[model samples]
Target chain A: NAGVTQTPKFHILKIGQSMTLQCTQDMNHNYMYWYRQDPGMGLKLIYYSVGAGITDKGEVPNGYNVSRSTTEDFPLRLELAAPSQTSVYFCASSYGGASTDTQYFGPGTRLTVL
Target chain B: EDQVTQSPEALRLQEGESSSLNCSYTVSGLRGLFWYRQDPGKGPEFLFTLYSAGEEKEKERLKATLTKKESFLHITAPKPEDSATYLCAVQSPGGGSYIPTFGRGTSLIVHP
Candidate 1:
């Protein structure tokens, strides 16, 4: 079903450059999330959306912004990127919340900010 | 605050061997504990979900059990294909948000 797809499997950015990581789901799910996995660290949520037009910040959202303008798409924006933002980003979607159901994750995008 | 900790940062098992990976957590109130398998350079794939103490679930050669303070993912008759990083996550009730707290994960290497 192409559960969840993330664009730019790999990316490189300068310290002050900005870029948006695009994610899309074809499962018609109601929940979508953006998470970053640093080396030797667990995936940390950056932002999430419950449904179209509704979004919220997560554990590590200071350098990121997100928008869910459509049920199928959720985009995470990195502004004035820093080396700290260089991590593998994954986009996931679920039929319900983590407390209720399983989440499907994308292949992930490896971002390197120098 | 919700937190998850997985034990045995890395494990190596011989073919036909059986071992268990541990995931311990602390939370205001437990909603669910999840297990996922992540291959190198790939995102995590969901494995099992344990909602309460004494609850158990199994798939193929993998079995997951939960307790009030921790969860165990038991692997039986390991194979090279089963080698990967096993992650655990917890969902707490107080956040008003549904984000789950994840552990650093246990890297499993099953040698043939």
Candidate 2:
């Protein structure tokens, strides 16, 4: 089963260019999250959604936005991207509460901002 | 703010060697702790979840144990494929959100 899928496995963006990272999951999970992982750093949450149309800012939400129009899809938008935004983006989904369920992650989207 | 700290930024172990990684956290009220393994250029893969203190979970050559202030991931006779960065996260309630804090992670390299 295609548990979780992300688009544009690799991309290169110029400074100030905007792009969206697409994420979809087939697990019918209630919780979905967007995170960025930098070299030698851990994953940092950018935004999350509990269900459709229910989204919230996470630890590092600045310069990023997320929308959950449906349970199977959560997209992350980057406006006026900067070189600091260059990192591997990951999308995760969980079935139950964040504290009680196991989070399954997508392959990842490697973005390079120049 | 919730905080999670993992010990040993990097570790090198010989094949078939046993070792342990530590994940320590401090939060207002912890709901649960999670362990994940992330390979290079890939997202994290869930390993284990510890709900409360004195809990333990095991799979294959890895075992995880939790305590009030920390958690341990013990690897027994590890192989090269087992080499990866291990991340630790903690879930807690704050204000009205259930935000989890993550650690920098421990990078393990197993040599054959």
Candidate 3:
């Protein structure tokens, strides 16, 4: 089903630079999420979408933005990147919005901001 | 605030050894508890979900047990391939969002 896929498996950005982390799921999931994982830390939600056109902030949404224009695509935008943004990012999707729904995750993107 | 804490940040076991990883959580009301396994340089893979206290779920070589305050992941007869970071998370009914709060995770290494 292709499950969930993320683009740019690795990247390095300079301070003040911007980039978009792309996420797509072929499972037709109605729920999509963006999370960041620092070394030795648990995943922290950056943003999430219930469906296309409905997005919400999560635990750590600063310096990030998200747009879900289609059920299959959810992209996270980092504007004016900072060194603190250096972390591994993951994209996940689920069939429903309930907490019990199993989440399928993509191979993470390792980002380094200098 | 919902919080999850996994104990024994890391563990090393010889192949065929058995052990358990602990996850303790604090939340206003628990909606679900989840277990995921993550290999190095890869994303997390869902293992199991427990919706209520006293609930139990099992997969090959892994059994997850949930209580009112904590969850335990028991790995039976572990193999070297079972080496990975095991994560725990809790979900609370938060105004319908129900975002999960995750623990740092327990890293396990089984040597052949």
Candidate 4:
């Protein structure tokens, strides 16, 4: 059923370049999140959305923007990418924001900015 | 500030050996605790969620127990396939916030 899918599995961009990481879920979840994981590090929240048309910043949201124009898609845009932004990006979704609800994650998108 | 920390940044065990991973956290208010397993080049896969202290959950060879300040993931007789990075996260109880704060994961390697 393609639970959650992320596009451009791998990409390399130069400094000052821009790109968008695409994410889509078929579970009709109301909550979506974007996280970046550095090598040997944990996932850090970049941005999230409670529902379509509702977006909010999370920890380490700098230099990133997110849009939730549809129930199934939440894309993360990197504006003026920097070398520090080189990390693996993951997209996740949950049925609701309940404390017990588990999040389903997409494979991941590896981005490198040189 | 909310934060999570995991111990033994890396672990190596022989197949059929058992071990435990630690995840500690400090938050204003605890909403939930989550455990995930991440394979090379893949995203973290959900494993268990504990909402309160004294809660325990089990799946196959793994069992998770939560306390007020920490959680433990016990691996019983792990196999090579179980080698991966184990991550821990905590959700804050701040008003209407669901995003979780994650800790640097513990890397586990099982050798045959």
Question: Could you report the DockQ of all the candidates, in the order they appear?
Answer: 0.67, 0.66, 0.75, 0.73
Please give, for residues B1-112, the per-residue lDDT of candidate 4 as tens digits: 7889998899999999999999999988788899999999898899999988999999999999999999999999999999999999888866567577889999999999
Which residue ranges in model 3 land beyond 4 Å of their true spot?
none
List candidate 4 stretches off by more than 4 Å.
none
Candidate 2 per-residue lDDT over residues A1-114, each given as its tens digit: 799999989999999999999999999999999989887788898999989999988888999999999999999999999999999999998875635667899999999999
Top model number, TM-score: 3
Candidate 4: RMSD to truth: 1.3
Which candidate gets the maximum DockQ versus the true structure? 3
The C-alpha stretches of model 1 lying farther than 4 A from their native spots are A97-99
Q: What residue pairs clash in candidate 4, if any at all?
A: none
Clash total of candidate 2: 0
TM-score, cand. 2 vs. native: 0.95
lDDT of 2 by residue, B31-103 (tens): 8899999988788899998999999999999999999999999999999999999999988886546656789
After superposition, the stretches of candidate 2 with alpha carbons farther than 4 Å from their true spots are A96-99
TM-score of chain B of each: 0.97, 0.97, 0.97, 0.96
Model 1 chain A lowest lDDT segment of ten: A94-103
Kindly indicate the candidate among 2 and 3 with the higher DockQ: 3
Candidate 2 or 3, higher TM-score?
3
Error of 1 at A69 (Å): 0.6
Clashing pairs in 1: none
Q: What is the lDDT of candidate 2?
A: 0.91
Per residue, candidate 3 scores C-alpha lDDT tens digits across B1-112 of: 8989998899999999999999999998887899999999999999999999888999999999999999999999999999999999888876687777889999999999
Candidate 4 chain A lDDT trough over 10 residues, lowest sum:
A94-103
TM per prediction = 0.95, 0.95, 0.96, 0.95
